[model samples]
Target: MHRRDFLTFSGLGVAGLMLPHARLVAAEELLAPADVARQKLLADTVLAAAHKAGASYCDVRIGRYLNQAIVTREDRVENVVNSESAGVGIRVIVNGAWGFAAAHRTTPEGLATAVGNAVAIARANSKIQSRPVQLAPQKGVGEVSWRTPLKRNAMAVPVKDKVELLLSVNAAAINAGADFINSQLFLVNEQKYFASSDGSWIDQDVHRIWLPFTATAIDKASGKFRTRAGLSAPMGMGYEFLDADPSGRYELPGGVVGYGRSYDPVADAIAAAKQAREKIKAPSVKPGKYDLVLDPSNLFLTIHENVGHPLELDRVLGYEANYAGTSFATLDKRESGFRWGSDIVNFFADKTQPGSLGAVGYDDEGVKTKQWDLVRDGILVNYMATRDEVHLLGEDASHGCSYADSWSSVQFQRMANVSLAPGRAPLTPHEMVKDVENGIYILGRGSYSIDQQRYNAQFGGQLYYQIKDGKIAGMVEDAAYQIRTPEFWNACSAICDERDFRLGGSFFDGKGQPSQVSAVSHGAATTRFNGINIINTARSLG
Candidate 1:
């Protein structure tokens, strides 16, 4: 389990933060790469042991996962940590059944024992197996390496520098008249090595970063409070993500600062404080059907739940039912050419897009990654599939969606960066707004609810504006939109072009029985959905 699983930060000390899978490490170790020759040598030993024990196929993953979190509130630094986990997981097919074992030990004897257990488990499970496992054919590249193109490694940056940045960000919020604020920076590095009996030797170094914070404003006289959150997106980049690149900033209407490839947290905090104060007196929505204009920050989560999760082949095939429920987009629906959206709607599943969390050269299972269509011209075309699941789709090659959160976790089909395609014609959010008659413009993610099947849902946003007669009238509060999955996508009438495109994502998207978190990104331009149901949340509460 990750640190987020059971972390209660109220009174925990540094020792308490450590898990068996992760331990506090020296700062220098964070930048150090694991030895490749030694990892292959260790893997070869495990493979030979599995083969000797009646295995037909074998693979090993040796991973070094590193993470750093710095949390601050108001004027004080709450916690700072640098942790690392290093281990190996071996999987084998014995008697046509899959088995797996993991160990922290890199010694040959320890790996041999893990191999013995894996083969034995597979042999026992084969007796009751429904059928032999089928994996699509894969030709491995003998030796290859890939790394996240980086200018500076965040982990290598001084702790003092990061802390000072956070402190300054908090001060900015306070100076703008915020009652309270919380800010945090999360950085992760995954150094992974994969070896298999199929002659594949692969190595990958991945980096991801996120800086999130909330600013609150209170009206002491009215006993009311409102908040605004930072617009920064978690990204697959180096420390440069925090830089205040003016070219990367989007000054949306109402003076709301929208971040793209880079962010300025200090500036965002200043804006957030001012926005939160304005939210206090913002008028309540006069709930009714209205066109909705959704910024990427707010639309990304919607795409993640309604589109990304439901189209996983594992979910549609019923092999996965733990993340709330299985998918409604079943095989028959996909094969029958289900209309998922308007002719203008296009969505793709990509794992190779630069600066995306899921942008890896190869998946954990050693398949070369690439982009493919999930929905093309509004028709359901495919589901995200791995080497083990591609046979269900009658495909010979994997979509390369396979991933394991850590060395000890079993590899499985995970969502990639599923994103909406931009409009072919030149368009911008400003131009798109001019065409609207009556609509609500929503920015950033807020409270959301979706059904177990990921069908019916309601979504809220951090900032909302009423658009009347082709213009933003002013701010509004307690606004949300309701949707039926198909109706929602089909309602997509207009989408801004690439110039307005931006990425937003979750750093910890949890799925499975023993839930594992995977970081994923979703990109979209400003988009418009017609005649959606709007709800007055305050009415429901009262």
Candidate 2:
């Protein structure tokens, strides 16, 4: 098989996992106004049945999920697919224990049966319960609807247009000296309706899109190969994200362009081809302790792994240890004033930030989403908590972090849009890098590994630039950094201002026993960490 063909098949396979199931329906059948009304009715029926079946509290989620993927290589379209999945999931508390059930059929009888099954499961589980679940108080916000404010709904866009875009992107990479290129555009639409016993009936129309591609430049003579990935991020926006914005674009210090709300895939592909070609000849780094300057693309994943995952209240309390692993940021660690970062470093977990993957008006459990401080003045101040987890931290409200990933999955504590606050005083990436005598500047996440406790870890990036005499010397390769979580964050360094802030996100962050995927974003300015251990990965391999 051709390399591009193999990549296209692999891309489709991953997209299948992302959407889970692809039950195809006519566009009108799946998206008509009547369908939404029917979903709301199904949710109402489930809630009513749960209450009648001796349940104290109940909520139902009726969802219609749509996904489209277009894959291309050079000037050829490999695959174009459209799939949909619709179902209703019901949850209830009976005898103080939680139970949940789901059904693909959206009929009134099917929903009622699902709700009854949930109540029965709750009662059975209560027989062996350690204690009744204590849920934090939440006042219901009456009937409401929230839609992602989008200039263009990706679902409404033509597949031909999407295919043309990917083909152009591939051509750009190949024209810029790429030996091989594979590009794909994935679009998702989640039409959800929620109704609960707490007098809340919420409906939401959510949209998300991701454009990812790999550009490889190979040297068959020396047998060396290097690849650069798309700098674009998965966003909770629409097709409009692909629109170019000259005014909003930032000129990065290292001659790279940084995108804000919009992206230019053709330009990024052109740059990726050049970068990958150069990477084949980039010098390998010499291992030593040197200050590290991190671009937002690189720092977002570090923040996700070290800060976002560790601070999930369920992870810290060991509720997720079986699958997702426990956290080192335990209750005692927070109480003892553990410094999670430098005094200048601050972090916030929010679901209210526009354009972030985690942004939603309300979480799955009907709690209104809001922002809160996670790290304050270098201290571990709070953890991401759902309604059930908040009371353990002596909090009276949920952090609105509960999410289910799909209608069939049970809701649980999930990460929010955790972000590092930019420097209060004026600063820029150039200014932050100028003071470093001997250092490395890293961009884009490459590979990473962390212990079960999310404490000790090592990270590598897509591009590394050697800094000598307070200037970017040249590109470097085979560089990775090792650190203990607290020690790593406490290195006390400068951060660029909000003008330099940007978001990077994950489309398939997995958790739980059945392992559902959640999309989340982490935002940060270009930041510095001082005197970190830089290892030569190639040297170690030898």
Candidate 3:
């Protein structure tokens, strides 16, 4: 695809196709600390200024965001860029309406001007408001701090080492006979401080890492092309996350490698190269219903799209419609106790789970993070909510789902670490497969499409294997499964135990009118579903 084609994706607000539009700073410059005490003083000034400007409630966020990106193709480095940005955003509720303002300057005079603008905007918005803003009561927890435990900060890792790692990963693929390969690494750190008129002062240091690799194979004689992506999940960890654990490995039936908390990029690249070529000679899937075995790697994405997004209170309430359309999981369904999955299916939203993208001590709104159930015994239990939105849900507490990608963006409702609980009964993917008559085993994430309402969807996977008489037969290609949200979950037959549980996530989950990208993780064990519809993606009907 051309650069123009990639640019057509409008879901991201600040991104560069090849290089970002951020201020390029020296490596040492990234170490410059935006002191917490200085940020507190700025926050205090903004909070006071907003209150003095006739605001009933106010909260301010001071942020310093940093990113390091390295890209490589084949055997050479393509680009290595380091960028930094800092700013402040203020939110205020005045006369029953909400308004927000932000500024790059952190001076007292700049904050005063921004606060005045925010309050004035809120007052003007009140005239056309449907209802007065009502926030769930929250007692302030004075001063507190939290950090993502790290053995080595990813940003601190020498750029030379990072580049060498990428080059070696490329060599593994090319030497294995892959025609082409592209690899990239992304590191993020957010230094943030939050202060509210309610007397809460919170400071947090967050770190995240993602290493994405893809290898391509071309059968020039037959004019065929196939590609495979590495089975590495983006994580909320430090540079240590790249260290592969010898014991944490899964031996799939087709000789595919399944990774755990620790990863081996070079090993994955070698396997990915062989898999890409194998796909060139794979058989096309026959369109029909068959029992399905989904690895955690593949199941995580299924849970993310089918279960997570639909349960957001903002989407259910139609407050967010321009992005993915409103959800089919409405408020009335929650009141009626709608059945979401099978008797054994359990779904929940969490923000306190260690190493999860959404795991934070306190949300952008200053609410302490915790775990909550979204589904229990297959029934819809609750939806994710923020501080101001909690009152509408007939609840008195927030779910700590509020977040903003940048300091200049206003915080809003975002998805948490939505996950499927492991099965209570001891079950393994191997044992569960012995009970199946005919099935397809899938691995890795692929192209997917769902209705704007997040129902009636199609999902594909990176690899497919035919299961015959409770045994792995051969590989298949161009396979996609279709589902009506409710029916798919109700078909749940079995799930592996905690030992098989793993997490998969997206670095760019877009939501809202002026789209904002957020990081989120979804976890599940090897799961089985009975009698599902399948389609051959290679077939084109005129």
Candidate 4:
């Protein structure tokens, strides 16, 4: 739904440039915090109505969402959009069945009607009920608010400033030898209020921003093309991410640079242009087994698909079977302590990590947010869960992973900010690379494919370098690696220490039947996998 450059630029494979959303929101129209007393009263009305209608439980979400997008190509501004959406969604459990209704009207009468409709629907469903809903106990922390610790609200920044930043970034790419460039800035602000019959009234102010672009290089004589995308990761911060800090940048092996607390899109665009041009002439990869060094940018998506999605209890329990498909990490496998990775592999689902997209005071279902392990010491330990799904795993409380893309959408279990813990040994990517004689250093996300169970998969990246004699030899193209999920993680021989950790994520990770988009982050230090099956995609294509 995001607006993006119309110019067709290919070669990224499956990881195409992210377009701006179609919705727009004016800055001034963004809703300010509503009076806490007033919102609680509104929620009380809905709760009272639901209880009167024979409901066992009820919750309400009132949300104000603001979005702004600035898109530019080459020397011209392509588009600018601003828009807002506000609504309330009511959910209730009646006769042991769940039902939901939403309305844009904020009036007490309107909410009461919506609650009535939800109860009616639940009753109708209960006629054919299989079993009653079983939700884990949640002791709500009454009446609280959480806000993103933003120094500068992106909504307060002028649209002119955003447009200027995009234009400047495009110019940098063009000046760096890109034949064509497309850049965009996306900003979001969400003001949400939640109230549930469990005696919890919570409010939250959330902000997120992404500056993404694609740079292309073409060889007119050969009629060949190549492209590279900006290395900047979409952040949970505000416009402050635009201001580069010297301390935040990390110098990696092979002259590769990684950002920490902030990013510099202009610098990334310049590098992207150079990398794309080099890609046009980079030698085709020679197919064979090789030690694969995956940068965080490239590895995040792999973890998202193969690890994050598969660990969702809903997916494993067969309650969710849409979009990307069900999980292979079933309860039997987890209970048996299946060896999912190497001893160095420890993956956890965290919703409280600072600056994480999933960080929040509580989940949409009013459960307190916390961190829990999915895999520990390379063994499957747990799965992501919501209030309703945790009981399947014998857990007493939700893993706090419930989410809804909008106020009008029904809340459901979603993936949290799952991450691979860093190596305890004080290792570094540069140090790890020195030990590799024959390997491929892969950076940034590229085209990828995974099976329904998230078992078998192939992955590509923005850049690939051949390593020989403990040094980066040169660039290579059309390189990809294939692996089965368990085998892939078991092959993880090395992971860099915390000093090199960085976050990589998608602003729009789509899942579910109605396909709601959720933002999630995955953090890892540079990692090495042994003897991965490297293939020459270009030769195979021809």
Candidate 5:
């Protein structure tokens, strides 16, 4: 039973078996457009005051965001929520130390007070520091504003309609033989404004949507069970994302070769559910060294854990020691010839890719975004850096990766839209699989673990299929792949062509002190790697 055949025979193709009934609720009622002018005024006033109040450097950031989430469990709708948040933060340098303060109020008086507090704090902190904080030089930038394009504003959709869509998906999952189904949909619209002492003013707006579906199958007679989960690739788009209905104006792409739009929640639900059923009866895998084929869905996590997190200059320099662990790959290793992967592996950290969740026109520090290499032909080339850190590294400029999860938090070096370049030659996913005589095809991401230093890691997946004699056998259960950083990328033998590449990401990527959640994207094509270690998760658990 090949992967495709398994999906087809398991009735995962059903359209709307468990579709939610809440799709009809009104969404616009929950959201009101925020005053962009007011936000801009708050930023400008705060920055001007900070500079006049004996501050050598100062910047102000304002943020407004709206989020709506819906979760469904089997036949019951578990959670439906809508929230709006807005705030402003001021950062100032007084006597050569950085200080920051924030307030939810954006009123003129409120912003003035925030700026005053920031300068006072900076003055206080400067007295205790041994050395003055120095920031890399940056040319002044004029005012700018950016907004992601979207067919429909997520807030315009009715809440009932959103719930109904989720319910419909749940129903379809149950119809596909799922003993239980858990589904969640998230939508966020964020607006940001920034003003700096360097004369840089920037405003940005982004809308994102994500759908996660999980299904569990149980052999009622034996109490045996398996679970499968699928997460949609997040995009800086809008409510049009949810328009993936087969019967509607949108149609899901067939043959899996082309990126297709799916308006049908039922289709996604059924597919997720069917995978769960097959996993329940699948044979447990045996641990060994084997060739592995990684789908884009699964490969994205590898890039995130290996390249994304580790390449953050802060993490590499131990600035993240209190939160996310530090990286073994340090600035010293970022020379031209350091081996980070195979010669065939080329990766980059780009903040300009269209539709990337991490894409931004300007960073929190008011620097323009740009593309740079993280791994060039498998060599360590670059680490994401902030304006302040660039000076420490003796670099002329920052890579524009600095970001803060919210207005209340200070900006720091964060992950970029890191991605692996696809092979120049065109190779279909099927063609790549045909070349593998004996291997395992892994799809989607699951549980994962990595050492504190990011030297060793293991990751599981939602679905695994055994390949024998150049064909997919059946599903496999309790499977995981493990590797050390250098050894893992060195084992890469081939990668699929660009046509098979896809983007995937997470919205709740945790980082920073006091804990903040940032969203980022990882893009990669289907790839085939040579001998790697595989584990039997069930046995390891026992």
Candidate 6:
């Protein structure tokens, strides 16, 4: 078979094998408006039943998802997928203990059974509890629904067009002499309808997209291998996101049109090839304390590990100790004027930022989302909290951090769009690098490790360049940095302007008891730090 034909057939083959049963499962009749109203009625019925059964509190979550993915490797289309899911979860507080149950079926009978099972579980668990669960006080909320703005629905796009785009990207890489190229694109559109006994009703529509690419090259002479990986940040966007130049203005996109220029993926491929070649030949780095300049891609991960996870009140209170370790930064310290960074540093956790991966109109707990501080002027200020943990932190109400990655999972406090506040004055990344007389400029995230307490941590990066006499010398290898959390932030000397900031994130950040994967974004500007411990990975191996 021709390469292109084989690629097309491969995708079809996989679809043929897996889709028939999946389609059957997803073919439930769409809920009519009256049916939706009845579902709400059923939810109220279940909540009332639980309360009458001696339950303290109860809530229900109904979720539906439409997911599609396409992948291509060099000349071969490796995978094509389309799937749908719908489910409901019932949660209850019985005698101060929590219990939960979920069912894929959305019938009134199914929901009633799930709620009954939850109450039973909670009653059983209450026997071993020490104190009655006390949720922070909150006023009753009324019905509301929100949908993110989209120029075109992702599902409306033809599958063939998406496949063609993937193939084109793969071909571009192959033309640059990449021995192997792999690319994957995923789109998910989720709809959730939530109802609570407090008169709160919420409907939310959220869309997400992910694009990841990997390329590998081999040297026949030395038998050495090198690879490059690039993963795009997931955005709350739609099919318009896939358009190269939706406005027809820019040679690339957004702007820069009318300027004598051309849009070509080959240019990107050439740059990647050159970078891969240089990285393989770069020399190992020397270990010592040195000033450092961090690009946004590298610094964002630092923020996620240090500021994001540590500031979660649940993690600080040891609620997450069984799985992910708890934070040394506690609630008391957060408000006690603890210094978290240099005087210029400030950070906020926001769920309303435009295009942010974590942006949500309402949390899984049915609470309206809002923005708040995690750090201000170097002082540790706030911890991400939900309604249940708000009282522990002496807060009035939740900051709306609750989240559940799947319909079956229980809602847990999750990270928000944690972001560093940009410098008041404009400072470009180039200027920051120029200010560093002798330092290393780190770009892209790499291997990372942090202690159980989240105090000491080490990070490596995809690319590192040595700086000397206020100029980037060349690419360097075997470079890594280690520092205590407080010490690391204290050393922050400057942060670049807002224009220098970029969003970076991971699709599979793991947390919770049953283990759930959540996608979160961290926005950061290029930053500089002083006197950090650097290591030579090549020498350390010996």
**Worst lDDT 10-window in candidate 6:** 252-261
Colliding residue pairs in candidate 4: 1-21, 1-22, 2-20, 2-21, 3-20, 24-82, 24-83, 25-82, 25-83
Q: What's the true lDDT of residue 493 in model 2?
A: 85
Candidate 6 lDDT for residue 181: 74
Task: Summarize candidate 6's per-residue lDDT along 396-448 as a digit string, tens digits.
Answer: 78899888876777998899889998887888777777777789888767778
Model 1, which residues run further than 4 Å from truth? 1-20
* Best of the candidates, TM-score: 1
lDDT of 5 by residue, 180-294 (tens): 8877777777778888888877888877777767788898999988887754577767777667644322111111211223334567667777777777788999788878988
lDDT of all predictions:
0.89, 0.85, 0.86, 0.85, 0.77, 0.73
The TM-score measured for candidate 1 stands at 0.97
Model 4 Cα lDDT, one tens digit per residue, 1-542: 12222232112211222222223445566545556677777788888998998999999998777777677789988676667777788999998899999877878778878988999999998889999899898886889999888988887888778888888889999899999998878777777899999989999988888888899999999989999988778878888988877787889777877787798888888889999999999999999999999999899989998999999888897767655678889899987889999999999999988787788888899988999999999999999999987888887889999999888889999999999999999998989999998999999888887899999999999999999977999999999999999999999999999998899887877778776778888999999999999999988789
CA error at residue 243 for candidate 2, angstroms: 0.7
**Candidate 2 backbone collisions, by pair:** none
Candidate 3 regions off by >4 Å? 1-14, 17-21
Counted clashes in each candidate structure: 0, 0, 0, 9, 35, 0
| Model 6 TM-score, all chains together | 0.88
Error of 1 at 295 (Å): 0.2
Among the numbered candidates, top lDDT falls to 1
For each candidate, give its TM-score against the true structure.
0.97, 0.96, 0.96, 0.95, 0.91, 0.88
lDDT of 1 by residue, 3-31 (tens): 35314321253333343489887777788
